[model samples]
Target chain A: MIEAQTLTKRYGAKTAVDSISFTVQPGKVTGFLGPNGAGKSTTMRMIMGLDNPSGGQVIVNGRPYAKHKAPLHEVGALLDAKAVHTKRSAYNHLRAMAATHGIPNSRVNEVIELTGLGAVAKKRVAGFSLGMGQRLGIAVALLGDPQTVIFDEPVNGLDPEGVQWVRHLARDLAAEGRTVFLSSHLMSEMALTADHLIVIGRGRIIADAPIQDIIDGQSKARVRVRADRPQDLLGPLAGDGVSSQVLEPELLEITGVDPRRIAETALRTGVLVYELTPLQLSLEDAYMQLTQAEVEYQSHSLSPTAPDTTQLTIPVEGRRP
Target chain B: MSAQTTTSPSPTRHAPRPSSGITFSRVLRSEWIKVTTVRSTVILIASTVLVMVGLALLGAWGYAQLAQSINDGSLPADLQAQGPGSPAVDALTTPSSGLIFGQLLIASLAVVLIASEWATGMIRSTMVAVPGRTPALLAKTVVVAAVAFLVGLLSALVSYLIAQPILGSQDLDFALTEDGVLASIINTGTFLALVAVISMSLGILLRNTAGGVVTAVGIFFVLPVIMQLLSGLADWVTDAARFLPGEAGNKMVAVTASEGALTQLQGGLVMGAWALAFLAAALIVTKKRDV
Candidate 1:
């Protein structure tokens, strides 16, 4: 188990990670989600003892990381893929790291074959591709076989097959009662792999719960309608926490109201409703809703004439349980 | 990328034994592996030995020509008047003469060994394995310093053997049992080990390969030349310059002490002090700051 208490990090005048506290439990995969520059990498670095915290502390397996007898065996982390020497072979890099803990050479070869780096284990890391580099990073993380494993952006450059492999590996590790903590920008991948989640925004925890609870809490009834007059159909459906976006002259996407309510309103108002469709809230949409206000580098769409692009400007007020 | 790669064995199979952990000896072993696994380190070490011995041979040949000119009465009037010392006594320094270039290469090698870890982003992996930070840094320093000491000792030993024949050609040969002769050969290694310590400390403080190399070169090479140019301005300048690391280390390997100059023991102590000061500052800073 990994526990952090009021962990804070500041660089000069700017705060990279605010005073945040959370716990990662064993026997499940906990996903760390945040927007760009939201302190995901910095948090991981502090946990690995690479970056000193400005305040408070983080503990792994009942003690601080450095206080452990064998830190590599206590916790293994892949904070960055480029952490190995470019000129050294992948096999040699693992050997050198393993030597610090008196780990034998046979185990080093085992990781090499396990990561499928046997074909190029003897080759220098300078020649490895992006996918191959991720494999090497994973190989290093699995070298000591610690009870807790942390990976930051593990599938950033992986292919589809590589991505699936990482997903399964995370699940398998968690199933064996190990604490698996991972971070990724791919929401779909996270949805498939993570059992629980700790979402951060602007260095603060926005949500911490089971993955299904997060999805359920951030979504409400959303309905899409095509009618002769969208404004007329939306006129009576404006209150009760309801909102609508005009997609076209005859189409409207409404939130906070169900399709049956819209159909009853159209029938009572004497408006012709051609189609009424209710959309299920996907993890991507829920994530956007949760982090819309916390995004640091929001990109403004340049194509202002696009009809569907108008919804991007709407404010999403988070409704939490 | 293969499907079978994901089918890793259980964590229990790879769990370390209860007795295995981070020890000073284990850290030292890890550092040794790191130094030898890289190609640049091996190449630099071999070249240091070769260049040191090769330069000593050239020094021996130059001294032989000088002794011949004095015997043939073909030496210039200024050269005859300013003989500095007998050519026989001057030839005693031939075994360590290569130190002129030896120090440069050794200093660069020491800086490269530590700074390259930061340059290639390998320090993160290193620190992750040994998070206390002190053991890993000290282990690397010990390995590099020990390698520098052996290179210096072996280079001087080989130069002494090969330069003996050339010195004998001019009747300027000296025995290893001569006063201060064997001490000079041994002190050559001691001086280089100190140089490596100081240079590696610079690498840790700067944490940039080019910056560390430049600063090391300035301390060992350029600083002495700058001191020489200012010596005529005041006697204090000349006195203070003697305490500089490069100047003090040169005295540590001198065949004979010049009048009013630092003795071999005093020179070694001064350079050792400088190395310790830099290393202490580096350790304190590394402990407090982020990697």
Candidate 2:
């Protein structure tokens, strides 16, 4: 398990990671969610004891990473792919790390095989393609059989097949009762792979909950109502805690009310409802809303193109505004 | 893709942790592996050894010719007055001459071993593996210093032993048994080791290859030259310049200290001060700063 308490990192007057606190529990994959320069990488570096926090501290297992007698056994982190010396072969790179811990060569070769790097393990890392370099990073992370595995943007340069492999690998690592924490700027990537999420924006914790809770709490649940007499149903659906939008001539999108209530209203009012489907909120939508106000580097358009959906999440209740 | 190839192995692939995690020996072993694993680094190291030995052999040949001139009484009056057979004696010290040029290559080797890690972003992995930080830095220093010193010592021995015949032609035998000669040869190796240590400290402090190389070259080569150009203009210039790392190293490894030069012990102390200062700075910066 990794626990960061009130960690802060500042460069001059600009704060990179400003007093953020979170805990990554064991036996589950906790996805670190943030946009670029949102302190995700800085937080991970601090957790690994690579970067010293300007304030507060991060600890792996029960102690700070450097304080552990066997740090690699406690936590293994891949902060960046292609962090190997270009002059050395991948095999030597892993071997050197193993030597520090008196870890055996058999395990080095095992991680190499596990990460699909056996084919090019002997080649110099300078010649590796991006995907191959990423695989080597994963191999290094797995070399110690560490209890907590942290990967920062592991699939940044992977192919579709390789991406699929990483997604499963993280889940499998967690299934073996390890604390697995991964970070990605791509919300969709975390949505598919993460069991729980810790979202940060502008170096602060924006949201922390289970994946399902984040999707439900940050975004309103919309219901798709299709009926032969949809206009008649719209009148009955107009009430407190209920809002409707006309998606089509025969279809209405209703929010802030359950489908059962809509179905009962249609029956009591004699509206001929053909279909009632509850719309599921994708994690992507939830993330966009959660971080829309906190995005640090934003592209400002001089004029409108299409509706700027990524920039502004549509508010469900205009009554308060 | 090759996971199937491991099917015949033991069912469990989990690694058993060693009892001691950060033993100095293990860190040293890891450092040795890192310093020797690169092909270019290996080639450069081998080249340094060959150059050390090769230059001594060439200097021996050149000194043999110079011995004949001194014996024929063709040398200048003032040159002869400095010391009747100083050229021949200095000629027997061909290994120190080789060290002048050889230190550059070996010092550069030390710089690249550490600074290039930052250039290629490999320092991240290195720092991650050994977050205690000093062990890795000190381990790297020990490995490079040991290799450079041993190579230098072997070259000095071969050079001194082989130069006997050439210097004997002029009846000038600066024997290894002579007072302070053996110590000079040993100091020749120690000076080279100091060069490596100082270069590595510069590399770690700068964390940039070009910058570290420039600073090392300036300290070893340029500073002494600048001191010489200003020598006659100021009394303190010559004396102060004698404490620079290169000049101090020269005095420390000479058969005897020259006129107006520091004694061997004083010279060694000065250079040691330099090496220790650099090392302390590197350790402090490494520990206090973010990787």
Q: Which one is best on lDDT?
A: 1
Model 1: CAPRI class: medium
lDDT of 2 by residue, B13-61 (tens): 2333556477889989999999889988889877877787778777777
TM-score of 1: 0.93
* Poorly placed runs, candidate 2 (over 4 Å): A224-253, A260-277, A300-321, B1-20, B73-85
Best by TM-score: 1
Which model scores highest in DockQ? 1
**All predictions: root-mean-square deviation over Cα?**
4.0, 5.2
Model 1 CA lDDT for position B58: 93
Question: Residue B13's C-alpha lDDT in candidate 2?
Answer: 23
TM-score of 2: 0.90
Consecutive 10-residue window with the lowest summed lDDT within model 1 chain A: A312-321
